[model samples]
Target: MSFNNLMIYRHPCIVKYVSSWQKNCKFYLAVEEVTPLSHVLPLLNTLQICVGLHSILKALHFLHEKASVSHNNICISSIYVTRDGSWKLGGMEYLCRYEDLSSDFLNKSRMNRYFKAVDSNEEKVFVNPTARRDFIDVYAFGVLVYEVFKSRESFDEVPNLDVFCDYCRNELQHTDPSQRPILSSILKHDFFNHEFINIHSFLIELPLKSDEEKMLFFRSLVGRLKMFNEEVVASQLGNLLLSRMVLLNGVAQETIVPFLLTPKSDEQEQTDQLFSEDTFKKYISPKLLEIISVRDAQIRLLLLNNFSNFMYMFTKEELQMYFLPELLVGIKDTNDHLVSVTLRTLADLVPVLGAATVIGGKRAKLFNDGRPMAHSNKNLPKEGTPQENEHPVVRDQILNNSISSIIDSHNLILPERSRPDGEEVETSTEEIEQSVDEDLENWDDWDLNENHSILINRLGIADIIEDSNDIAENHSNEGIKSIVNTKGDLARSKKTIADIEELDIKSQVQNNENDSFDFFHDMEPVINSSSKFLINEDNKCDVSLGIDKEVSSKLALNVNDINEEGWGDGDWD
Candidate 1:
């Protein structure tokens, strides 16, 4: 191997190093024994994919940033999944620091099929040899991501491919190195989404440097408390984070409400293990009230986004107490995004309220016509943690678009009752739909240039792109492809590299930037409630309950039918 020092390091993803000795002219490399990643193709699951990808990303990050080296070859054969299902990135034989190698050397060293990355300028792929080859890791990371998601029985079958961004099923083959988002950004991306895979663990911090560092540091503090301050740790975290989110006891607990977030109970689990009832009541609830009290559009939107996580964690009382009132308030907000997130959140909330009505006496009374008008906004110290908005910008973006907004599968209209003086009533479902259609028509007419390219407007109606998240190159990318039907537009398929090619690989989204939303279909009725439902064309992960008239019209899907699983457990990547 070129870099013998590779034997010295240790990382969870990297194979553990053991001592090696040379006998005669022959040299021996003793290391932990593990099967090749290629050896375990059939055994891999979405959870293993997340665990492995994250481990590889972290391993690459450590190698590139800390050690100033990049694994020249990051491929299936080189990597290995641990017995516990965690991935271990190996292939130290190809390790190369930022050396000023000649083009010939680079060419010989890299496997043009996957390792070689084309530069943005599109001259020669390996033009500069002196600069850090960090982007290669990014490109490789993208390729590996494709391979992991698009599995195969053997290495030959693992074809190069693209991923489905909320916008399109685009190629991961980015020709440019700089265009590839960095390791830090990649970690936070919704693409490597722990939620989607139901991995139940995600420790990726925000994409912003300051925010990422702040979160990582606070996480370190939490870790130290467990390591050294075991006695006072639990309460200490409560005092510090103002919530017991630290003592995450798989809040994907035995809890149920009117609606379910996931279709299957066993397949569902809470990864983020956040916003437990007590956590919300003591820490998150107060902050939300602060935001609701002030009513700043941007801040309120951000706060709502941040606070929206509580909905998944809400019980009947918690939903009626915190999420329902605040989210309904947000529905009245002028901003499209705010209304979008609030409404989708409301879609998730109503079932819980209904469940309360189904199971409890009049706990749903909180949701009556005389309910509160709208959600407000508040200002917390920007330097606070997730418990206190330490990195508000990243926190807000992640919470709003990715967490709250993107999953906006439905909306409802609060029908108005007749006044004793015979005053006018609230807007009917038809009228509200008409008004929404008119606004959409006006907005689309202005932005849409029909018969040209597809319109790329920020028209949100569902979850954040996700309130979401990434590119790559080299090798044959032909074969069966999976397509996510987002807006039911063929134009999307055409516009994207949905049909693959070598060049013009657009960058994959690593955040909820410039993402759009589509309108959902309405529901009839269920549970004697006036709330109608809207179902996003794409996300059918939750119950799509809706009918008409009485009983049968009552389209109340069980709250996730069985408590839908939660999000990332905040475990570090």
Candidate 2:
């Protein structure tokens, strides 16, 4: 059978089954062609190997706990590596048994006979078969891990697994499985200690190793484990990898050792153990401080992304005091995407830190530094003085818009105070009032008045005379001056008369305020009386503000339309 057919026929990790069905055969024979370990081992890294080993061990533990099935045939060759670098136990021919089965039976029949025997009597007489077998699998897995670490060399070629197995068999021959050292003990045994030669030196040198070496090592370890049983492979791999990483990083040993060695669990000692100056300098400080110095936006983003995960292994105070400055610098990035992500991270972290001090500090610095917003009026000459004639209104509006955009983009809503302890704390309402007052203090700084005036003029408000009487009064004064100077002309006189007539019309309209009010009140009746009336009224106006006569009449009719729809009768003010 092909690999595809095998995948379809059996478990995912196993190879294709190559056998034929035949009647009158004493027993069935199934042969599986597996991928060689040489082809698989080099693909895994230290981390991947560790994860695979961890998972395998856990799976074994689970099998023992739930199914009570011990897979006694545990070896590197018995484990198959999946294309995705996962390990699975296979090749069960070597499984051990307490009962001797007849040679005429197939491997399955022998397994069944062994399982029956173990289930019947051995479980009660000796340790539970499953648990005992799981440990055996674990032991085998450790050997596989050792094999991978030694680059697939035989146990005798590196450290003899036979010797270790013999030692285990001799020392842990008790009937009670509890008397045996578990997989962890096996891992930390003196035999393994010989394997970890110069552990302290190796760890200390890991940081200095090339990234390529780290990547290759990790890949090879994982790939090798996948060629074996993935579960056992992953568990052993994970533990060893984590152990190496901790040792290499010096984080756990440095932070955990001295305190654990000490007798008293003093508060100060505990605090010191949890946080230290060297801890900050080693992990948090360098990554954060390096962000500012690194010019690449992509690199900065990657750093920021990793910073969160790194900080997860530390406390809140460590993050804030050490890493926050680097995070803040990213927020000021010219790249919109970088700035957006940085701000998002800060927004998330604010609640975690529980204090506004860091954010507040950044906000203050941002405002003080005269950043992009300071150069908002790009139209103005860069070298020009304040008096050299830039429109203040335009400048002010731009500045306000920029500042508002920055603040809004960050979603920096101020915290509301209910008092954390539920006490009725007396805060000065005056401070709140003062904050509101400060909102417009920078209005003149950005030049918004000129912009507002330009908008008003563009809207034709300049042409709309405020009062006709005022126009009339100015025209009369001009005429009087012209006459007094003996410069009065026919054109001037005619212009003055026209101005007076327009003023008279305006004055009449202005003086009839009560009539206008009455007209508004009675508009519906007038409009309903005739369409001619509506058209005649509309034609009198120079410009329509888009209000149709019918709509206007309806609005007039419902002037006190508080009960109409959304308008409530409650005091709005």
Candidate 3:
């Protein structure tokens, strides 16, 4: 019945349970069986020896201190080896509940002289279950710790090894169980302190025998990745252990990416810092490259989710050379899931690594599967029209458009911000957020290692699709003409339709209701015209539905010609 209660205990130091069955009246419990610890001792390395002693004592400590159970027989023979290259304490059937100081008839079962619990009243041949449980395990553990180091000839110079061994022997064999030292004290012994500062490297390297263990291993690794102070050890664990596990058996990208994006220490629920540099160099880069190489859509989606984080680590050339091709492929992909993920990643990257998305050393080509891919190094079109070669009026027109786009934060904003210098600054929501990486309340005053200028080169959605096919019909033809007449006109139109709408909403919030312009019906972008380039003054260039429209912009061209002598109202053809 106690063993049934004990079966619920889950820890790395305990044997794993799988299933149970009954035959006739007796029941059989099936569990994972492995090599005996007694056989693995001589072959153990320094790290392994430290971890093994820790694990064995850890199980005994948990059993006595946590579960209030006692292993009447505690020794090397009772300790089992697991397939994971670690040790576990088992033989639970010989376990007993911790009782108050009382009689014990355990001599028959306590045959291991090294581990036997003695009583002052030798004839009584009994021990107090409650008082004896923890101390008994602690004393036995001390002996085990001694045995672990006794095999090492190199430890000959370790001054206190023999003395520590003698101390453990005296403590374990002491007739007064109350006099024995506890597990923690033995762990702090000079023998262990000088040799093993940490046992994580040894235990962490052991193979995970099941999916559950693998999951736990990864979660633990990621959890520890935020230990910025212990970065070197953490890096080695992630790069070596994490890489090996992922290669041998893959992990769900969803499961791992979130951990990668937001790292935490043991104290905080949300953390702003991690050993990001080392993590990127060792863990993120290799894992990402390997995962991307697989070409799995779902896995790729997971990768896309974390691409924003990747921007800070990768240089512009690396992103352009490595990431852009696959992203282009994702954009043209027919699979809705892959396309969505790919587009999202690009959408995030454009604002931060905008230049990287431009067709660079390789050109985007229509590939098999009807997707676009980077084919070869070809000259991408140069930016802006050669205004130098155009007529004066055309040259001024290109300049005006260029200046307007730059002022709008690449056409991403609508509302104008008033600056203290009396200059109105209009920028995007992205621009405002980019200045400082504040996350509402949790974070403030910290800036990511990214610049806003990259976003300046980013063409909005309208720009990317403007030359595609029928997308031009949805836009103002006047704006379209300027975009068509000049190279990178589409790229120059920085704001997406959604961005404009958002800006519209924001501007409306700040303005009087009547101040709103009915753009679809009345508002039209005035063409840039000069005295020498004026068309016929008879016809006004109007897109309105035969109605007066609220002309909001100062840059709107006058339909009527203005002369130096006097102003005359006349339509332009």
Number of the predicted model whose lDDT against the real structure is largest: 3
Pick by lDDT: 1 or 3, better one:
3
Off by over 4 Å in 1: 111-132, 152-172, 193-573
- The sequence of per-residue lDDT tens digits that candidate 2 reaches over residues 361-398 is 33333346545554243443221111122245643433
Q: What TM-score against the true fold does each predicted structure earn?
A: 0.32, 0.23, 0.37
Clash totals for all candidate models: 55, 39, 10
True-structure lDDT of candidate 1:
0.42
- Residue 455 Cα positional deviation in candidate 1, in Å, after optimal superposition: 99
Tens digits of lDDT, candidate 1, 144-172: 66666664333321122133331111323
lDDT of 2 at 514: 51
TM-score for model 2? 0.23
Show where candidate 3 strays beyond 4 Å. 1-6, 24-27, 100-105, 111-132, 156-163, 190-573
The candidate maximizing TM-score is 3
- Worst lDDT 10-window in candidate 1: 473-482
Question: In model 1, what lDDT does residue 130 have?
Answer: 42
The reply for model 2, stretches above 4 Å from the true place, is: 1-38, 42-59, 65-68, 77-188, 191-573
Model 1 scores a TM of 0.32
